[model samples]
Target: MPQAQQLDPDTFAVRHRIVLVTAWLQVPFLVAVALLTTGLGQAELGTIGAVAVVALGATVTQSIRARAVLASVALFAASAVLIYLSGGTIEAHLHIFAMLPFVALYQDWRPLVASVGFVVVHHVGVSVLDPEGAFNHHAAQHKPLLWALIHAGAVLVTVVGLLALWKVLEDASRATVAALEQVEAERRRRLEDAERFGAELAREAARLVDVSGRVGEVAGVVRETQEASSQRVGELSRRAVDASRAGEETRERVGSGVATMGDLEQRSGEVESLIVLISEIAERTKLLALNATIEASRAGEAGRGFAVVADEVRNLAAQSADAVDRIRETLVAIRQGTTTTAEVLDQVEAAVDGIQTVQAEVVAVAGEEAAAGEVLAAQVHELTTLAGSLSGAAGTMSELAASGR
Candidate 1:
């Protein structure tokens, strides 16, 4: 078989169905010819039965090409039988030409050629065998050759026209199949590209999630450090305030001590003046006792007893003067000690004041540090929250990409 003759299964099936339908259609024409010739006799029944049998056999056949070939032969045979049975009716001859176009359904020129050949051979054979039965009329019997030529010419024209049309349809079918194949290839390429893009997107999303998680971890650590530092600063601030209070108290106590030392120094000065007056009185008494003793000696022997009494008084006065001198030395030592103590108290008071000033500055600095630490802690907390949100967003994106893939 030629390439055109060997059709795909679907094409064969379609041609097979056309052949069956055409075969059945021929039955009416065959019946009409039989009725015209024999008037409802056995010949009409025989012709219809033969064509029906052929169509049924072809339909049941396993091979599509065989079915087409059988159907073509059956149709051509029916055309010939109908013409012969009608006593070679001219109208019955048209059936042969009509079959040419129907056979073209096979999309193969071979079936058409076979149909044409069968018609030519049948006409010649039947006309020679029984001229009266093949032509029916006297005129057709005399010029059988002329009639055969005219019928052949008509059939040839029909064959040429149908085959040309078949060629055009076959070309179109092949082109359509090619176009569909190209479209399918493009669709497959697009699907593969989408899959590749989805994979890359999923990887990027996962990377973003990882980066966000790391940032969140760092933010958490920073926030924790800020909180600890803030707590320590607050504690230090409180301690500074307490230290400032203690320094002030110490300064006041030192001031009080210095005032007490000043009072002690004034009392020591008054005691020193009284000791000087007592020393003068003792000296004057001693001089008076000595003069009394000298007057008693000048009064002679009667005044001897009085002179002894005066000497005893002068001795008592001398002892009193010596005691006064010792008392005056003790007072001078006490005055010197009080002055030194007062100077030391003044130095202590000044040191306490300086300490209080330094403590006040420390308290101010510690309070400022605590306030700054609190602000830093708040900022760190905000950053941590932002990082957590970013991490969550990246996670959601990753999940969506995964689901898309």
Candidate 2:
């Protein structure tokens, strides 16, 4: 009935040795008790057979139950042989009681029960069948059955007490073992949790490190882009100022051009007036030439030369009127071209103003962005450092968990 698994390794080892040693020692012990009971060899084959049985059961039995049951039963036989050898001495029975504790050491009641049964059978059977060998006194031989019952009762009482003690021991041992196993189970569970948590933390830390690294790279790129943008904004702003300045100069040039245009307009007006006066003089000359031709016709052949001079004067007046008309057409074209050029200059100045406003705003926004970028880069650097620290902690935890496992 003894289960080896119930005992922890340490207790099992110690009890194992004790049981084996005691079982083996029973052989020599029986021999010594027999010699001590009656100093010499009065018996022959019975003692030898009994001793041999003890030896075989002690030595040959493998299992704890086999060893305990066989050895305990054999000890009863050995004690019976000693009793017979001693002529049924009262003290030879003590050997039977002595072996009980040894089997009781197994913490298994079944072996004790087996030992008791063997003792009962041997006492009744031996006393009834061989009273001379089973009893030392003639009084016991006359009523061996009563004597056997008395001896069996004594053994049962001892066995009952031992069984009580065995019950307490069995309960205590099982409780201790159960408690130890529970502790080991909880310990193993805690270790598994620690290993799982450590592994998970390590993996998450790796991901954090990767993400932080990428964040750092992205921050660097953003920093570079911001720097470039800031510089470009500065350049544009400078260009805008230059354009504003250019716009001022253009305004001044436009003012000068307006003044020049006004002078050109006035001069063109004078030329127009002069053309009108010349046209009037040409008409008067044509009329005077016509009147002279009439007078010369009245004077006949002497007036022929005067009439030819009037015709040349009329041709000269017509040619002068045609030249004045061409001059007025050219003046009108110059005035229209001047007005278009002035309008284009005004538009260029307005566009320059708009460029300057947009450039100034861009520069302001770029400056704010640059400052924000610096702050973001600093935070990202901190995050990367923190992630590294977490990774290191997780790595250390993993090492500890692995070692513990």
Candidate 3:
């Protein structure tokens, strides 16, 4: 059994009022028809007036059951008046069926049942009381019970089919609502998942961007350090080259000093030889003076002066030989000092050579360091570029995440 409570109440309310109010349209049409065909009289006015009262009563009633029952009575009553006013025309009879859809639109079988029941009663009452208003044909007029039963049977059949269809439509509507709710649930879930994933992606992107920024900053610092290192290496290389050059100059000066010392040593040896020859000559002279003194002593008193002169000459030669001996010792000491100075100059030359070699090695190592610094700086620059790219990618991801949220 269908009750007045609708599956969709809001829609039912609007349609319910429309059904009730629009049922009045038939009243005026029926009245006009009555005026034209049967001519307006007391019965027509009385029927139409009663239907208006019933419809108004339905509007005022709070109980859905009473309202539905009253609306149904009004519809059938109006149809009856329309049938009578049309002189029981076939067109006028269609109003009864036409009113059924409005009742069905409310999705309530109460109005349908009530309308069917009212029609059956009205037909039974009318056929017995006044068959002309119900049937225009002779057979329907004569056998009014059969025609009325047939009409009631037809209405019952249509209402049964309509109720079945209404049930089908109602089920379909419920299924549609359920399916829509499920779809909405799925959509909400998907939206939540998207927002969560987007948030995760944004967080990861932010981390990447932050890490990239730090990397870029570190790389930039490293690049600057490497550039400074390269410059320092270059300066060190130049200094090494200058030191090598200075070492070479010092070695050359040392070589010249060593050569000069060797020459001086040779000259000292020659001077010593001359001093030895002079000492030998002085000894021979002393020997000759001693012999002359002995000869003079044999000559007596005249030779006394000659012996004194010979002794004096011997003393002078002895002094000259002593001086030559001291000169020879001094020349030996000079040669010894010259030999030491030559050896010292040689050592100094060797040290300068070692220093030059070390400087050369330093220059080579500095060159290598500069090259390595260049490579390091290039690597740092590449890292900075990589960080910039990461930042750009992160920014794009952040924008995408923002839009998603």
User: Pick by lDDT: which candidate is best?
Assistant: 3
Query: Model 3, 186: alpha-carbon shift in Å?
Result: 1.9
Candidates 1 and 2 compared by TM-score, better number = 1
Candidate 1 stretches with Cα past 4 Å from truth are 1-40, 72-162, 250-405
- Candidate 3: Cα lDDT at 134: 87
TM-score of each: 0.64, 0.54, 0.82
On TM-score, the leading prediction is: 3
Pairs clashing within candidate 2: none
Q: How much RMSD separates candidate 3 from the native structure? A: 3.8
Over 1-405, each residue of candidate 1 has an lDDT whose tens digit, in order, gives 223646778767776787788887877877776777677577668767888888777778887666777789789888877876777878778777767767877876666667788888877777677667678678768877766776778888887677677767767776887898888888788767767766776777677777777777777787788778777767776776777677677677767777776776677677667767876776776677677777777888877888788778778777776776776677677667767876776777677677767767777776787778678777777777777777777777767666655
Better model by lDDT: candidate 1 vs candidate 2? 1
Where model 3 places Cα greater than 4 Å from the true spot, the runs are: 1-5, 17-21, 40-42, 50-75, 277-327
In candidate 2, which residue ranges exceed 4 Å CA deviation?
A: 1-20, 30-37, 42-49, 61-67, 81-92, 105-114, 121-147, 166-228, 241-362, 372-405
Instruction: Determine which window of 10 residues in candidate 3 has minimal summed lDDT.
Output: 1-10
* Deviation of model 1 at 405, angstroms: 4.6
In model 3, what is the error at residue 164, expressed in angstroms?
A: 2.9
TM-score of 3: 0.82
- Alpha-carbon lDDT, every model: 0.74, 0.73, 0.83
